[model samples]
Target: MVARQFIVRHDDDDHHIEHDTDDGFEVLQSQIFSLTLVPPDQQKILANVNDAAINADSDLAAVSDRLVLVSVQDQREISISDEELARLLQAEEEAVYLQQFQASGNRREFENRVRTYVPQVFLYEDPMRQEAARKTVPVDEIEEKSLIFLAKETSGHQTMKKAMPSYWSYSLGSKNLSGGTSGMGMGVPLPSEIQYGGSRVELYWCNKCSKETRFPRYNDPIKLLETRRGRCGEWANCFTLYCRTFGYSSRLILDFTDHVWTECYSHLLGRWMHLDPCEGEYDKPLLYEKGWNKKLNYVIAISKEGVYDVTKRYTRNWHKVIRRRNITTEADISAVLSDITSECRRSFSREITSTLKIRDERETEELETNVHIPVGDSLSLPGRQSGSKEWRMARAELGSSDQNNSEQRHKDEYVDSHVTRIHAAFSHLTSRISKEGVKAIKKLLEDLRASPFRERTAVLESQGIPHLGDLLEAISLKGSVRPDGRVSVGLAGDPVLTSLALPVALDVVEKIINKGGNSD
Candidate 1:
């Protein structure tokens, strides 16, 4: 006897396991186990072997050993070999490294970096994919039953009758029941099988669509429904509003010259489809510019997402379009577009992924590049001039605002009317106040400080700054300084008015000072 040490192990059940065995004894034990393993069980053991064969040779054995260990643990009692345990850990580490490599090579990050080379001015906001996903909800799909009813009601209108497609009448008259909701309780009349020409004439209805007939006093959809006669703009606005009521992503596209139309997101097409309600046309994007032979310089599309200058879509020739778009220079238009796109990205649905955003930006860049032409020393054709002091100041205010308020201006007729009234008053006051001298404007400011908040905003809103620089200089010269760094001017009796007016006054002064300093 040689001095030899033997080791023993026990599981939770207190079953002993032998260790420190020679190759000869272990082989004999394996032979005995193999003899007991039936053909059915051998298939289970070989399944892991087949799985390992598909992997690379370096990790193949390690993976197979791990699978064998797992199968053994599940099927029968067995002690794990130390070599197999080490191989299993090696395989896991290799797997983790491979995953990290794959994650680090994300295509999205690469695409984003590529997009950085393109100018921000060239980027645009697009929400087609997001709008498509939103269409999955029942509420998002427009009740065609409502459209059918509206078409029938407006079909007799001479202008609308010409515009209405024959299929619309057939679709409504015939029992083609696809894509229509249950109109039973919705107050919508059922489709009539009896086909009839649109020959009905009501006393209030116009024999021919006139300019006066189109401008409805009320532009709401409900009101439009009651009154079947409206202008192209009104019809478009009402149609867009109705589409929105049914949960469709809709926008009112305005051609700065005069025309208006609706753009509704089409889930079937996976993009926005132009719908001219007045004309009863769908997806006819070029109908205005091409069909009507209209010269369009600017086509603005306003939606809840944001405002967009979609002139490129309407104008194929950039050089010709830029000549007509002389009201705003290229630089100014670029600034406005950038402001609008940024605002949309901030406020649009969160589901809009970065990949889609980048794709939209690339498309915009292509459009911009195609249309861009250098004017150099040559000026564009003379259009509407906005060089007056008040117009210039308003332009400055619009540019200075954090977000472009152009969309806000076109949100509704109510807001537009208020703005128009305010603008007119502002123009009058600016001219009179400047002629009367800065002293007269300073007196008006002193009166405003003591007024209430409502009165202060009313005056500011009504009488915009006549000469921002002169007004601010007069205030700083006439008003007393407070401890809090605000000028103590305006109505001393009303604290809210004084508080509101002082900040606004100071902000105007700072902007004027900055503007002058920048020029110098």
Candidate 2:
């Protein structure tokens, strides 16, 4: 049998034509043919096809036979013109550009833009044109054979079995209930009302501890299942396998942040629904079940349509849990869990109050020791007396001292008494301010400042004051009382003394003004 092969090239297409004959096939009209030559001393054998002869023959089959009988020994060569070559190159470039644009979602528009350029961009070489002139077998026969081979190779694998009706049962072993133990415990059953015609298989692997495991096919069940060992990613993979094994389309979806879950297409719903077995069953309230909650940390679900629906329910619940844990200063799991309860807000508020009380007490003691007050002969009353038992004893003996020292003792007693009264007043003011508003306390301070010095001193002495320095320090530290009852540096643009000194200064100023600005 003789066979003839022609290589044809167009601007953007290249194909081969083959003809079979009894004798060596002949090209009826020659354009270009392959030849072999020996060394310079030897003859060269050339093969050529006569295109005119083939065209002249009315019967193509008879012409093919005759051409195969004739042999011409000559090397045929055909070169493409520079312009044609440029055109071919241009066509190739355009094809690549159009393909890229199409891939980027501009297929129709790109094709329209290139349509006018296509004709000018493609040019056929002489050899290619001559090849195109020949006739050969139909193209469909070649395509048919190729498809047959592909089918043979692909269809050789064993088809997986259909899912069993019993497999749809929620039972693990004999248990009727769902979601308790692995294997023996009833697995979470697909809702019976929801018709699913796919295979089902369970998978298991630890995301954190075990090597990542991927099931070879959807139909294969996971070899092991352990509740505490695996994370959400592993659980998702298992569920996906179950659906795939049953011949239902399933996929393990992971978010950008490595959050893993399973998406199963429900034939009934005609949509993909996500399931998070590892996160546990959805709670009763949609917000509590799917919303941002502290116990679950971060949770977000994305639909196939590319919508991001992050549940703030989980987040809100988590925030409350953290706040409760922090306020109670309880680092235990129980405390953390308790905070997630409905009364979490009230519980945390109580904790905050307790902490504030402790802070206030410490602040009061510090203020009392830090204040300084001048005594007789430039001596500072309560000078380092905070740690002195001797000073306390001397002060305590003031009433029992001899008559000679009585005047001096009286002076000391008076200073002590005055300081005590100031301390008491400041303490009372703070208490009232805390209970009432700062505005009420500020008005009281204004009235005290307008009172006579003798009257204020008499009240202080009657109160049996002690530690004037402590009183001054407390008043100075507390600063001014704002209208809101907060102790601030300034109030209504006026600077007020510490809780201790506000009354004393107001009384002294009032007395001096009343006495026509006379010095004490």
Candidate 3:
């Protein structure tokens, strides 16, 4: 028997133990007992697939996989700090993510899946066939219960005037129920399951239609041309095919956060331009992040040409989005994508493929560059413009209409509170940090705060995101924020405070104090 690794979580931390014992999973419990002093009955061991037993090596898969042994005792819950619990949750998420990552990277299941589920499958054939379909939409005869119609109707706020279905239990509000569980692949769609296995069933209400209304859930995008009704998925699918049929090299993009859009390669600009058919939006990759306020993770673009991970193109907050990308190492994902792209282009001539490879490299560079460089000026991007106002708000994709107003109010309050903190820190630092004339630096900041907005704007620009205490060290020396909240030094980290040597952390403060750098 091959030895397996187990994370024996006892008190403060986790202990990894190896076991060659066979027979049943009780052997794992026994091994855990030897270390944690927890009895066999009290130990709860969980795996990625089965929490109950591991009869073979096949059950143990993926790099992040490990057995989590939880002790069932009185103090178990109480002893865990919020940080430790969060860490354990992240570990569990990584394990589940790795399982899917390996499965997605498998050449066999992947190619078949790509053929079936990837947006590239929705192709353009005869223009006449597309025209005919566009001209006609047959009444779709669906099975009585096959369709799940979900909705949120409101007079103003989200409230249920009429009682919903008694058996309809939803993870969120009044969505007409289709059952899902808490187990892997069985449960309600979770944050961690984005890239691996997914299915789309747009939940929208039909006005003046009965539950028995027979509408066909057409898989083919050509059929969507005539019907012309769908959520983001259908809209993007239909539009992508239309673009291709019209002689544009188009791709369909699937956002793992339950949205879909189109991308068309522009010969004029020699780049793929973002097109959200639903939003009537064009060329704005950061629209979802800046406008709809969508916290996106995985956004894969697929066409007849190739598959691409285009998530970075759609975000400026790559730092936060990175934590959700635990499906696999980026290198493994690139490997899988490269293989898939090769297979996709196998039919093309060597010259054509070479041209494609160059284009791919250029696009890759463009997307990576976009990760750091931000767009948009003083006026923020518009909110989600496609869905119903209520629906958009429910999705929290309503962007910065009323949100900007509320945020401004909150920001004013935050700035007022933060100014007091900055003043204290500045005072403390002025006493300790004597480099570059601390008095002058202090007076400079004080002038900036009391100065008019135009004068402050003349001096500093918006810099990095701000936080006060612990994070202050991270921002300090590297950047500065005007106490009035108008400007931030180091707009994209050029270091506007380079001339002044200021105390950032406790250690720096201690060193300065001990050196007697203060001019008292």
Candidate 4:
């Protein structure tokens, strides 16, 4: 059986109504008839229907007023469930939301919001359950049904409709082909693999310079070629439009620092390559190799995964310095390069550490001044005084010889243990803050600090330190060694020196050890 569906909207009430007919239907505005037919007579009837309709209705309005009459010999049927229809509607809604989010530059926020709501919205909607109830048909059966419907609708006559090919077909071979029967011309040259093409245009705009920019040739032709100078964003957009006009897939990537570039998918290369047209001349390559060094390796490092890989490359380069130094194995340059790199990374991390340190200092000052105490158990004046005494006792409990050790030892040890970790964490944290802002980092830090293990574990993990449990076990097993070369039995399990005070005291010792080590 054949069916026709059309939508009518009333301007008076802005209401849309859909009308469906089983027989032949005439489109008023287009003066087109859709007809269904019986086996032997179907083709003959449809072939003459268009001419008959045109003769019967002198105008488009008269053609639209004509009633559609359809004849059916078979009773085969197909049905769609309400649940399936709902799911289809939901998918469409989600697609629209995603499109709007991307267009508004809120793609990330939209993803976050959707993630936050997905569970609540889809808690009862199970794909497996829906599929279990869904009807299934063989591929041939579906194809046969579709063909039958087409034959019935056309009344054996070919339908007159505009032909539009798929995007892939257009990109591959849509040009140079003859009308309707021909395909897009294949072998259209792809966009040039030049980096900073868009960026160059942007830079030119900033510098108030004007120049012609070239893009990869694709079948689709660009409209509105820009002549005046524009920024990197403008240039990148223009380049993207040109590529799109040629049926080439292109993207514009803008960085937090206002760095803009263009990327296009190269079908021949089977990879998306970077193009920075703004950085160098239009004809220059994207990345250039100078001996073993790769220059202008511009990539969008947007996530921890991306940054981690990039860092690994830098770390590997540092390792190469060891072999290239041409010194004894004992004088490996790996440590030197690592130290320099670590220092640079630490410099960046310091900003985060400094901010956190300021917060910590403020909290400490508030605690000292007894400024509002956090909500929890209340401490009486006597209890507070006793707590202070306990803190003093904890410090005084340390051995005289331990306190008398070289002051530099404490600084060196603390610095060694904490500085590298602090630097790395600080760097990661700063990067997060730079991309997502301070509020995100602050919330993350707050969550981490609330956890029993604290975010310090992240620092330890990065430094390849043993797990906290193992460290605690080690501290428990080897707590204190006396000057007499004997293990202090009670001290091993002492809460004061072994567990409570040791980690804090070690921080000081670490600073001293590092200071002395650096001096040597």
Candidate 5:
């Protein structure tokens, strides 16, 4: 048999007319049937439908003597079944549509399309369960799944929302009282009260109320709120969930020494800021080593994005941290990071992957160059750079203000403790200006006189007393102080308590009458 070629053009392009080649014609026919070429004109190509008649054609017979019949579409040079042709056309249309979308400037639109290819990551509260799931997934799939997990909006609620301004102000102002729940009332407090509350009152409440459980629980924020508290690990876990619920990108940072906190990504600042719910502190990475005097080893931050060894942020000196770090080699860390990042990026399109890779490189550069280091000069510290006199004075003022707050906090605690002690001793005393009340008032007066002007103010404010006038009014003209601290207008004609308490009452009254004017 001799090879034959056929010239074919279904569109404007010139056709390569192969005059005498069997293989070329077969390939060309196959291309047409595969939808590479527009289907040939039906009137010209299908002269005869019967196999014998098609085999009789000189051009068709040269390629294949069998000359099996094939279906052709009218719109294109396609010799395939109708269903297959329709699918190929739809696929082509979709490809073009995606190309157009990707070329457009809308990053969100492109991201939406890219997400279809990524597998959904269902992260659990349990780390062991999460590790099991992680093992089941390919390394390349981790990043995309992580991104989805980070931004997962379940039931239209964001897990990582930015916190309110009041919260920030309160967090920044309040002192880090690591333990004790004294002075923090159970009732919901005003925003200003939290700022001026003098301690981590919420953490106090959590510690006091939450039942101690032997089994570990990485409770969500809602559950923690309901239960009122947990261990340090649970506190950090819940706090992280709270940040995420508010639409903030937060990571759960775990220290080998059994401490956990959160690192939130600040979009405005374009970096992670350390936040500790237990301490009521933010952006204080060095607090662990410098303030708490902790000896840390591995500090890992695990987020949906990936797992990162963030020990460098807390440790100022690399040599010291390296010695302490339990990880055998830096190469292992790098390998783990690479595997996680690759898994996260697995489902991303080339463009998105490239963009993220570049961004990651920039972040790595920033992390390496900007890790906090100790400064010899106090004034040379980051954010407190030596500058104009005005700047120096402002820094000094801030330092002074913090010191003053601390001092006032201690004084307020003293008064509160004394008052609480009195309450404890005279548990059945109903009236604030009774014999027992009078004695308590006398003790408070003696303490208040020794206290600086600020402590007096703090006691008044903290105790819900409006002014010194009210206190003075209660001392002189009262039968007894009311539950609300108001003085009764009339004098007490009857003595309810035994004579033993009468002297304490009279003594308290005499001291208040003489010292009320000098109290300020």
Candidate 6:
């Protein structure tokens, strides 16, 4: 009838606590019993200030500002492993999300909805089945009885695990040469076939009359199961579903730089393991960046439980990735992802939510720490494991097998891209600017070219031209194009900018400082 509270600590657990009021003091004892396993009769609910038994809410209030309960049954605390608690919390959260999901959706549309939510990233692979089976099946079945046969079939054996990487890499299925392909649609696609992205287009070479058409990238796992084919997108999509179907808590990892993979909780290893089904690679996070020389800007992981930004997990050189990360502000990205994750757990208990928060922070610490690890040359770093040689070469996704050739070029690409941006936007100044200014600018370019990529990168980030109007801000030279197709630049009062210098150059520089406009 009356609301009350207590800060209860039992078994020396730092984080876990119990405090609630129900029917009476007896009910509170039952609550403590549930957590500490000390019978209500043996437990002593006492106030910290005076060790007095808290018989009633008034007695608890008399002891201190807040009530305190402690089990005096045994001299020692109860045994509760962190692992056991985490697994319990995770399962509880899953049930909440699943419950909310079931209350609102049609089973037939579940797979399609996942694709619509995250067109390119969602993993919704379901095997081919009859209409009755498809309509009747649910995720609950997979969650409950997934391992009854799947593990025994493909992944359970240690030898099969080793053979799997090579099989999926080379034998699973060949890459679809026509990327922008939609397979063999004799006529235009129906409304139901229209995908979220423009990826379902009829290719130029795909003659509908001939029926020899581009195969559209399939999202259905059952179809992928039969075909056993596709790019990394298909591989990860299908593989993640395999993991989920096998009862492993899995995530579909999407690299914005055109790659996808899987991460599943490895109870044997006590952590999540990276998996590239297309490459037949396992536990090699750096295989893409270090092995294939990928310039990753973003990597995100999505699962039924939550969404996570996992970019640092794949990248060794965080600075380079940061420079390329212009898609959105980092804060906005975090806020949006956190909002989505929070929405999924809106109905979850506060204790479960707290555990998730701790897990999120711990995962972040792990991923960020990984960002600093020195890039290593692993023997497992083979070039472009999945797709054909031609496709791999076309994508330039070679691994360490070709690292010797690409190592230097990789550095040059970084330096050149920045230097080229400088040239494209500011090179015109050489002709219109004063001779002294032109000489100084050319000197910097020469120095930048000769210096190491790291040095050049530092110089770019420090003061290089990010745009047409902001060239060499640290050096006091600025330029902007005029609205009427004219170039204007500013050279700080230097010897070349005297009465003796070209009047045209001075006029151009003055106009740039005065009226900033678009480039020609």
By TM-score, the best candidate is 6
lDDT of 3: 0.53
- Report lDDT (CA) for all predictions: 0.40, 0.32, 0.53, 0.29, 0.43, 0.52
Per-residue accuracy of model 5 over 250-311 as CA lDDT, tens digit each: 77787776577778865433357787665555677876665444566667777655566777
Q: Among these predicted structures, which one has the highest lDDT?
A: 3
User: What does candidate 2's lDDT look like per residue over 38-132, in tens digits?
Assistant: 11112211222544333322444444332221233222222446775566456545544444433334334322332322221121112332233
For every candidate in turn, the CA RMSD to the true structure comes to 32.9, 44.5, 25.0, 36.6, 30.6, 25.9
**Per-residue C-alpha lDDT of model 3 across residues 204-257, encoded as one tens digit per residue:** 333333221122334566555545545576667666666665467878787778
Model 4: weakest 10-residue lDDT segment is 158-167
Per-residue lDDT, model 2, residue 410, is: 60
**Where does candidate 2 stray beyond 4 Å?**
1-228, 255-259, 279-520
Residues 90-159 of candidate 4 have per-residue lDDT tens digits of: 6545544444433434334423322332222121133432232122213233333334334334321111
Worst 10 residues of 1 by lDDT: 193-202
Give the Å error, residue 507, model 2: 88
- TM-score, one value per model: 0.31, 0.16, 0.43, 0.17, 0.36, 0.45
Greater lDDT among 4 and 5 belongs to 5
Residue 16 displacement (Å), model 5: 52
Clash counts for all predictions: 7, 44, 1, 51, 25, 12
* lDDT value for model 5: 0.43
Candidate 2 differs from the real structure by a C-alpha RMSD in angstroms, to one decimal, of 44.5
